[model samples]
Target: MSEPFYITTAISYPNGKPHIGHAYESIATDAIARFQRMAGRDVFFQTGTDEHGLKMAQTARDRGITPVALAEEMSGHFQTMANELNISCDRFIRTSEPAHHAASQALWKAMEANGDLYLDRYEGWYSVRDEAFYDEKELVEGENGEKLSPQGTPVTWTAEESWFFKLSEYQDRLLALYNEQPDFIRPESRRNEVMRFVEGGLADLSISRTSFDWGVKVPDSDGHVMYVWVDALTNYLTGLGYPEDTEAFRKYWPADFHIIGKDIVRFHAVYWPAFLMSAGISLPKHVFGHGFLLNRGEKMSKSLGNVADPLELAERFGVDQLRYFLLSEVTFGNDGSYSAEAIVARCNADLANSFGNLAQRTLSFIAKNLEGRLPSRAAVQPVDTELLETVRNATAIELPRLMNDLAISQAIESWIKAVFACNQYIDAQAPWTLRKTDPERMEAVLGTLFIAIRDLAIAIQPVVPTAAGKLLDILGMGADQRDLAALTAKGWYEELGNSGFTLAAPTPIFPRLEVPAED
Candidate 1:
């Protein structure tokens, strides 16, 4: 059996439509999942909407609709966005699902049984937008002298009868977990920030809210819903059929990763592990807090009138083009900015002009000159050997190493270097010129380019699935053979030649993207 690899994205809050940030996380997580699967892992990728919250309730009320009705309507938009972006999530869980409610209640009961629950009167500043409670010291003063959450979201003073979890009791344990694992939170920066916050000490967290009832009801606790974070965090388990010892629960429990935005690091790194420890459940292997996506060096916001809808961007640039640009332009684990011009230039240069052009010209040369027949083997030369080696190193070795370390941009960079090498080899060898002088040697050169293009296409499929798949199909490669192992296998080219698979007049896989006109 392949090793099980489980990953998840922070479920989007469905009070609004999906944005560029949502698309970025989904694309990044999906790429990792696809890479792992192609690398021979049994991967389960989960992404969805966080539908139960005060914000959901308030937004529904403002719109004169019930919260459930609003959740259904908005959650559809997120699902549509994921589909449009080709997110390969195994499950799209909604908190309103019966199984999820059961899972949340079960987790709450387990925590309560461990003596972590207590009744208390809670009075503090709460940020509705963030769905987080903030300590007085963490608040910042607004220009109008009003207290704001650390994220600059509005906060209100609230007094309520709430059930509290003894989060302070796990402070020492959480620190010890951090010290022992050292990688529970990724990107040294996020780990350092979390360690500092824990060292500052923890307060008992309010686990149930009595003011609103748009969430999972606390087990045996009347008139109260579980804290949105608690219900939200439980979703990771619920997707795997938790609270029941089923096959998925047994195999994929203790998630491999929880890929979330940087702003929510505390909730995952601090509160989540503590809750699992209280429930006697295993903690996830890692929580990676990726940085935000900005709009051309500025933070995107509604008031700024610059929040880009991901679907709109996808429509403007092709889906694969958008995916390739984001994965290449942004250094993972750091803030990235995108613009129309940036997307167009990046995709056109990397996809259309470089790899796409190399594949198109090489294949077209073979189809037009060789009557769409596979090139026969000719005397192997040192130049051919060297070119193949360069491509193998990039596609088979360097790219995998960087991808495994979550260095997505660097991995693509390595692949592009190989693409550049192929372009350079074609130019220097001048296969078109050789066709007349030495047809046999020309056959050898085209054969070498064919092998290199196949390897490049297989390696990059995880990032640009549609375009790469189309190119591979044109190359007569089978779906079963598009993997890392296949990239290094011997004699596949000979087998393709024997099979007499003819290349067709190819359509361009990656068309150059145009910048949309200003309205």
Candidate 2:
């Protein structure tokens, strides 16, 4: 049986529509899921709306609608965003679902049974917008002298009867977990942040909220409800049918990775592991805190009027183009800035000029000069052997290690290097000019180029699925020959054609994005 690779994006808050930041996480997670599936792994990728929070109830009240109704409508927008971006999550869970509520309650009970839960009076600073708590030291004075969360969101002091989890008791254990598994939290910066925060000592977290009625109810108590994070984070387990579907729970629990925004690093890296440890459940193998997406170097915000709609961006550019730019343009652990010009520049330069053009030029050469058939190879020349050897080594060794390390931008960059190498080979050999002088050599040149293109497309399929598939289609790769598993099993240079594969009449896989005229 293939190994299971479970990954998830932090469920989006449905208080509003999806933005480029939300789209960014979904696209990256989708890429990993696609890559894992292509590698023949059992992948359960999940993403969806995080319903049942103070924000949802507030948004509902302001709109004069029921919370459930509001969640239904707004969650649709996120689902639409996922669809627009071609996200491939296996389950799009909502915390409002009965199964999720059951799972959250069961997990709470397990923690309670472990002696981690106790009834207590909760008094602290809380940010409804962030759905998070702030210590006295963590709050900052805003421009108008109002107290705010460190994230600049307003906070209200709340005192209520709540259920507390003995997170302070797990402080040492949490530190040990981080020490034992250094990659448990990713991007050295975020890991350091988590370590510092945990080293400062831990507080017993208020796991249930008594003042809100819109969250998951405590398993036995009628007055208190599970804290929003507890309810929301449990959605990951709920997607796998925890505590009920024992088989699935046993199979996919302890997600391989939870891809999330940097702002929430503390929750996932610190609080989540503590909760899991208390429940005697396995911890997630890794949590990656990716940086924020800014618009032309400014943080995107509605009040600032700088927020870019992801749907508009996808429609204006192409979906795969946007996906490529998101993963390729930005270093996965670092922040990225996007603008119309930046998006257009990357789409055209990387997609059209580099990857797309190389595929077109070599494939067109084969189509026009070789009668739409892959030419039979001659004896491998020294140059052909060197290039083929390099390309083979790239597919077999370099790409998989990069993917395993989750170095997405570097992996795509490496694949593009091979694409450039093939282009360089064509330019040096001048396959076009060779057609007249050395027709036999021309066949071998195009054959070598075809093999390189096949491997490049297969390697990059996870990032640029649609374009890669089109390239493969035009290369006359059959359905069975499409997957990369076979390519890996049989070395890259081994499948040199004999009778020749027929080509599809090519359309430009990527047309350059035209810059919109200025007003």
Candidate number of the best lDDT: 1
Q: After superposition, how far is residue 286 of candidate 1 from its true place, in Å?
A: 0.5
Could you give candidate 1's per-residue lDDT for residues 189-259 as a string of tens digits? 99999999999999999888989899999878899998899999999999999899989989988899999
lDDT of each: 0.94, 0.86
Which 10 consecutive residues of model 1 have the lowest summed lDDT? 372-381
Q: Give me candidate 1's TM-score against the actual structure.
A: 0.99
Q: What RMSD, rounded to one decimal, does every model reach?
A: 0.8, 1.7
Give candidate 1 regions above 4 Å deviation.
none
Where in model 2 is the C-alpha error above 4 Å?
A: 489-500
What's the true lDDT of residue 102 in model 1? 98
**TM-score for all models, in order of appearance:** 0.99, 0.96
